[model samples]
Target: PALHRQRHQFVIDFVKQHKPKKVVDLGCSECSLLKKLRFHREIELLVGLDVNGAKVKKHMYGLAPISTDYLQPTYDQLCIELYQGSVTQEDARLRGFDLVTAIELIEHLTLADVGLFSAVLFGYMTPVAVIVSTPNSEFNPLLPGLRGFRHSDHKFEWTRAEFRSWALKVCLDYGYEVAFTGVGQAPQGQQESVGFCSQIGVFHRIGGRNGCNMLLDDDADDVFSYTLLYSIKY
Candidate 1:
């Protein structure tokens, strides 16, 4: 899971550089990244969205435990919200966040669904910055015994060129500037040719809204949306 840790660190570092006050994580399954981010007291609001109702419920009811010491009242003061929703669908309820993230989640969706997801993330929510990470199909051959994509649920994985092409198109369509990077170390002999185990795309919105005006509907469909704002150990 070196790639997992590296992806997490990349996201953490990105957040540090941007210093956003409001943030949203698009595919926050267990809120693990949210837990790590809560340690930063400067973040005023943190929202997590996922497609699975059970996972959202677990995070809300405190069933999903986080590994961090219970301390710091300042951390308790930060707001943490969780919702169950699909990235492919447009939900006007989540708009105006300063930072939005979709780490290691795009490959789970089909190519067509990815288009819809891109529209939702870039057009609807429209955060100041967005971060995404996905498996680099080019590196699969370097992994021992790995014959196919990294995960069974992943519909398709893209090579570095493919990923860059798609990401560049999105940036152009959304009026955002983007940069590419990678996670994990390259294989020994292939270090000069093959890059990292995972690829990342960072997008910064151009002349976009900068406020944190996200509002959640209390009566929103129970199956689609749920909100929780509280603090807990990392």
Candidate 2:
């Protein structure tokens, strides 16, 4: 549980350092991270997308400002919304955001879906920066009595070497730079080999041509598939 919080903290630290205005959380299951990001004045627009529309609708209300928020409002105006959609599909509404996050989501997807997700996220939506985290299979051995994958829904897990290789390939294909980091260090004596329990990949777009300037065609811009569930403007 502590490590889980650390994974979210890693992302929060990124937002603090970069201060992106428009941010979206891909695969935002319960809007937990969105709830945290809502407190940051730096973000102007916050969006959350999940394939489980019902789940998103149920928990998204937690992101709304509380009574005290109305009394002591100091943050900048914020517009937050939730969407029901798949990450693999292209959504015109989601393109060109400053940041895109997919924490602990890739392993749940099949290998084919992962390819489509990469093309859509890196090649199409093209956020300025993307943060992704997944369970480190190498650390699985240290976990007592843990069997195959960390989660039953997870289709596959990757070792540190495998994840690094895949992240580098995405950078090469999509014209980006990537840095690797993780949380939950391994125990004594095994720390050198196992590394972090949750590995993270931070990808930043290279050069000036990004999602903002790349949107030119009217037909492509008309593509909107995700259903808008709820929105709040403050």
Which candidate has the top score in lDDT? 2
C-alpha lDDT score of every prediction, in listed order: 0.77, 0.89
Task: Quote each prediction's TM-score.
Answer: 0.83, 0.94
For every candidate, C-alpha RMSD to the true structure in Å: 4.5, 1.7
- Report clash pairs, candidate 1: none
Give the Cα-based TM-score of candidate 2 against the true structure: 0.94
At residue 222, candidate 2 shows an lDDT of: 63
Which stretch of 10 consecutive residues in model 1 shows the poorest summed lDDT?
A: 222-231
Tell how far residue 33 is off in model 1, in angstroms.
0.6
Candidate 1 residue-wise lDDT, 1-234, digit = tens: 666777888888887887888888888887778878866666778788888868766766452334453445445446666777788876655666788989999999999999999888886677899999998888888899997777899999998899999998988887788988888878578855777788888888887564323343443542333344433333
> Top TM-score: which candidate number?
2
lDDT score, residue 194, model 1? 77
Q: Please provide, for model 2 over 117-174, each residue's C-alpha lDDT reduced to its tens digit, 9 standing for 90 to 100.
A: 9999988888899999999999999889999898999999999998998899898888
